[model samples]
Target: MGEPLRGQAAVDQLLEVLDLKQIDAATFQGESPQVGAQRVFGGQVAGQALVAAGRTVDPARLVHSLHGYFVRAGDPTVPIDFHVESIRDGRSFSVRRCTAQQHGRAIFLMSASFQLTEEGLDHHGPAPEVPAPEDVPTMADWLERYPDRAAAFAASPQAVDVRYINSPGWVQPGDRDPAVHQRVWMRIDGRLPDDPLIHACALTYASDLSLLDSVLSIHGEVWGPGGVIGASLDHALWMHRPFRADEWFLYDQTSPSAGGGRGLAVGRMFTRDGRHIASAVQEGLLRRIGG
Candidate 1:
């Protein structure tokens, strides 16, 4: 939730980022956001890689699941080349593997599965009961309260609107109880196209935002002075239902384990009406840098 790029312009920028340049039937290139970030965001790479994979498959096929690993820290100043492999193209399902390379080194690797629309068993985990998104204080509220962090927040690139039910770790270090569960509300800062792929890709980008933070929650650690250090190691996502990325959704997240310098987090996305839309799991590299 850095810098408020609210509205259609933010959404447009995100869409543009996800739109990869085709280099060949199995290769593409994507640009990193000039957000003054030191390293490319993992979510951006994941979403763009998915876009590259999706581009080579039938439009009728929709992405149902994706698993990716961060092989190296990506340099944000350079463009990433995505080389996709057609693993298989079955009658009803297509599988693809994508490797994101920078400086001739693989920075990320992903395998994704696409499927034709079909009926299936319809059931989902129950959504957690929480205050409506409107009732929660947003990042904007925190910015107002902490005048010192306003500059940093305003300068960061954020295409999504994020509202936390509790104080974000960076804002109020060690303020909350040590717990494994955390909840937040998020949606695109502006309107997006009607394409389901676009929506899925957008959510893919947004999904990485606060996931690892759930791991830090257990230690009452936030990402500020004397905060915890963490980075995503691997990520997996499963799409359950077609949904708009521009609409509000609840991210119910929990961290069940942390040891050996790593932490694992899992989350579920639920629409305002309680429809479960997706599931995400990630293991992050965690080091106690300070408090």
Candidate 2:
């Protein structure tokens, strides 16, 4: 915290960039049958709400957990008004509740907790033995190598810096053996603020990129041309430590179940140094309508 007003100014700028007002609300709105039926990007709301909640707490207290529900399809064009409610301000822990509204209706809600860290006993699951991102080609490089599916891959804004840790199935989709786990490396294209909250908001944006796709990947379903209608129903995240969003972070995802037209996926995010920074869980409607 520099000058209190200066910090506030920076937070305001971050929110403005993440603001949902300029996006098309109609196209981004609702999950009903009449809509365009494309997957409503989950990271959009998650990142926005994280920024909203982060604005409420002290900079020393970093977010450790957030739980949110997608009540309805968000109108992408209408500015989503984020109403932040201060929940608590304990000495070591603080909490915030945020509601995202469009057209006078609540489309999303979230509750997040922040904590001022202190040294404590620690243990963590072993890091996955995957190939380092440096050795692997960048996503853009890979996409250029395969000209056919480049258009589809480039459609999502997230593809800007996101890359897979494994040889992906570019095309020729069919059912294959389900691999329970998957990994990817991601980071923002430009430098971001040093404030912990900004990094966390950026993390929220990156978290949902390929999460649900992990479920489809196991079934060998390529992500285009009628593979399935996938949407995230709810998202929860726990930030275990501090990290940078401009630097590559490994997102390890797994699907424990996919049945009854629904799928559940869990994710663990770790720094290149092997420190566990965050974990996430998401459940989605993954009905296969045919390709």
lDDT of 2 by residue, 102-143 (tens): 778888888999999889988888778777887777766766
- Provide the lowest-lDDT 10-residue window in model 2: 25-34
lDDT of 1 by residue, 92-118 (tens): 999999999999999999999999999
Checking candidate 1 for backbone clashes, the offending pairs are 3-153
Error of 1 at 154 (Å): 2.0
TM-score of each: 0.96, 0.82
Best-fitting candidate, scored by lDDT? 1
Clashes of 2: 9
What does candidate 2 score on TM? 0.82
- For the record, the alpha-carbon RMSD of candidate 2 to the native fold, in angstroms, is 7.9
lDDT of 2 at 3: 16
